[model samples]
Target: MSRLFRDVEGGPLCPQGSVVCIGAFDGLHLGHRALVRHAVARAQALGVPAVAVSFEPLPREFFGKAAPPPRLTLPRAKVEGLLALGVDHVGLLRFNARLAAISAEQFVREVLIARLQACEVWVGPEFRFGKGRAGDIATLQALGVELGYTADEIAPVLLDSERVSSTRIRAALSAGDFANAARLLGRPYAIGGHVIHGQHLGRTLGFPTANLRFGGKVPALSGIYATRVHGVGARAWPSVSSFGTRPTVDGVEPLLEAHLFDFDGDLYGRRIEVEFVAKLRDEEKFPDLPTLVAQMHRDATEARRLLMNEQQRATA
Candidate 1:
């Protein structure tokens, strides 16, 4: 089991020594995976633990809360992905005013040296941190020399002649290109959360839904999508999902509403993963409830057809 730490002031997460990889890791894209894998390999060679460090609220999000960039993965998904990548320790440092004010030297001395006892560090080619974003690979290397550690940056992972990055993945998703996004992510792009109670509006419209809140973070994609829900049965259930604030209903917060075809069970309070198969259309407001219901009927029909074809192709 991977141990998780949430603050730099905590006791040593890896006392002996750790090979650490540090980044925002918003999406855990192919490039991010390559860097973490390098850290894991180095840790094994050095016979130490592998540690993955990330920041919650991301630096950009903390600074730009009024209009933060769309997030590819939530905090829970990020931790799960890091653990699945074989890290022995995961640190999700809180990115607040105090942390943002720390200088590069202090970050290295306190967090990397004192808390993690890092013997080696790995980062991506474009990684930067510290106040004014002053830290770079060179900065880490310089500090590593004095701090009894080593540092290196990994080359970006490339797919189809383009470098894999969170930005590219977001662009693909926004453009409704799930295949391209999957190639960059090394897996399907999915959102996981516990189903929460809603106003039961979908049920009245003849389309009951399992709703998941976005937790105030900007979502990477917002649309009607063909999806599959996992964690309920022996197989993934086909679904049509809508992610957006319900403008027609005067809704304020972003919510993901998934309507599982032919499913008739309580999903409230259940955790599930909604995997994107294809984007059907952009979220839009209908003039009235009847119009919205009519549009939903068409969406369900199209989503069902797409999902059936997708399953056939997968089995073939």
Candidate 2:
């Protein structure tokens, strides 16, 4: 069977039994890492697979369609990150109206017991689930008692006495505080996707770029930034990046466009990660192409300086 599954109904994925961790897990921040790690450890000791269960279109995203919350990471990134944390399988369950309407008891019996055959289920603090968000750790524990399994919640991971959470990370990113975001995430904030063709206007402006789409999801950052592009060469490539709808070009969908400095290459179809270093400015429209090009020049210069300082600090 594939290591990833997307449905609530399926043949037994881990028929023999499995250890499980559940969460929204956007960004796979430090708190999330702790939960997955603990589950992986338990799975190892018990000689079973460690599975991570999370929802795509997350519950909040589905219910808040009119004003959807910003997504810290997209579906692919979330699954890849979960698997990287030693999970044997990652379940990005589709969360639509049908799934949302199921009661907590049905969720446990259908997903946890019937599908996963979970031997142990783990969740982070204050985790809730099922229709109307009725399920909690106590819910899981109660269901486990009747279903011949064990359920437990891990303590919240903290920094400076405050919980490390995706919300905190998003706030840090919004504030252009990459350092604080990284501290909470245990790494810098980045968005990764395969390069796609853009309008080619940047080419005419002398700032050719590699563009990436946000999978029709709201991105946490929406502005020009100094960034480092990874998965392009032996080392991270310094660059300037923009993550927003291109107001100057009449764009309506969020896009990530990175201009690698002092380099030349074709990146179409190449998967790369854009690590945000510092925010340059909020996205804005220009009066004309000439004005936009002029501002682009200034943005590039500032980005280069910021990335240079980062390199210096790293070496120091």
Candidate 3:
């Protein structure tokens, strides 16, 4: 699949006729996968390219003026996951006020109809778009009839009789129910960012953590978690990570400090991906540095044991 940045000009460039689906696709959860798969299937049947359109910064975050909710997948991760899904192209639209104001009618006519020449448009059952979220499935269908195209709404994919959504996944993660979140997401929950410097308290305590600065939206789950760190080598190393303001140090601004087992490389400025395997505890304030250090040691040992169990289970 091809991933487009904002640089590609000249409007939508799809093959002669294409099937397209558009959404924020924040997490690319099971629900999104179902919709995307449907669009791809339709494209295959029509012998056309399947194009997935997604907005960067999400429309809400751009206009809301407040920090948007923590996203499950950042742009890079989203693009990687989309490519793995085997779609023909992913349109990463840069959302600006000008593009935002385009009426739903005009969007369909200009982007979908004239630009992409889409033969079929697939959207989620509850999909809404255009100025002020004014368009719905019926509007799309009506427009499709006028434009010689077909509009189809794919029902949400359900898990345990409930629809899987990015919101639900976020809630589950915040509650530290990673198993359930992973089930909905179809993969382990991960956060991506560049390694930044920390207070070096962990180093003084003999932990030596690599602090990460969030690049996309915020992060889910503010607690201690068992994680797997990537970018150290071919395999992701098991780690124990804490996400919160270090109360013992009177720290501010939530930070993720991960102590990689047996790792001693300079990771500053390196972009790394950390996958959440399990949650160990909620963030808490320790009475003193000694107490915090003791708790960290316990966390490390437990994390190592859990990682071994996971590896053994996989082999079995």
Candidate 4:
């Protein structure tokens, strides 16, 4: 079992000390994974637990929400990804105004030295933190000398001669290049959340959907897509998905709606992952509900065709 904490005020979560890795870890992409893996290895060598530290709401999202950058993963997914990467402890510090105003020295003294009792601190090449973004690897190393810890930054993970990063993954997704995004991510980009009740508009149009809200964060991609819904059975189910504010329905918040082919089960309150396979088209507003329905039929048909081909290729 992995321990999780949302604040730094608590007493040492790892009293024996830990090898801690800190970053935004928004997508847990290849680079992020490498950093965590390095920390885990260092922890094993030092006989201490490995701790993964990140900020909730992300610093960028906290400072700029009006037109915040698209998020690669939600809070829950981020935590799950960290635990999956073999982190013994996960700390998602709250990133509010108070935390934003904290000094680099204070952050190190309270969070790293006191709460985590870090034996070593690990970060990426481009990592920065503290108030006004003043902290860097140099700052961490300087403080670590007095705090009885070591600090080091891991080299960036490269793919196809390019660095693997959340920004690159977002760009690939925006351009409808799932293959490129997957290559960088080391797997298909997927959104996981619990299903919630919706307006049932899709059901009325003869296409029922399982709805998942994006938790008030901007999604990295917005379009109709050919997808696979996991957590239903032994295998992933083929689906057509839409991720955006439904302009035709006057929706204000971004929602992910996935309609599984030939699936008729209760999904409310069930957690599921929507794995994006390929983008279909951008979301558009129609003049009437009938027009929207017609367009949806076409989208579903195309998604089915693409998914069928993908399955056949996999078998081959």
Best by TM-score: 2
Tens-place lDDT digits, model 4, residues 1-316: 6898999788778888899999999888989999999999999898999999999889998889778988999999999899999899999999999999999999999999999999899999888889998999999999988889999898878888888888899999999999999889888989999999999999999999999999988899998999999998889999999999999999989999999999989999999999999999999998999999999999999999999999999899
Per-candidate TM-scores read 0.98, 0.98, 0.88, 0.98
Number of clashing residue pairs in every model? 0, 0, 0, 0
- Writing each residue's lDDT as its tens digit, candidate 3 over 45-159 gives 9899888888887888778757667767778778777767767878787888877888999888877876678999999868999989999889999998888899988887889
- How far residue 76's Cα lies from its native spot in candidate 1, in Å, is 0.7
**Residue pairs with backbone overlap in model 4:** none
Clashing pairs in 3: none
* Runs of candidate 4 exceeding 4 Å displacement: none
Evaluate all candidate structures by whole-model CA lDDT and list the values in order. Answer: 0.92, 0.93, 0.84, 0.93
True-structure lDDT of candidate 4: 0.93
lDDT for 225 (candidate 1)? 95
Better of 1 and 2 by lDDT: 2
- lDDT assessment of candidate 2: 0.93
**What lDDT score is found at residue 73 in candidate 4?**
93
Query: What does each candidate score in C-alpha RMSD?
Result: 1.0, 0.9, 2.6, 1.0
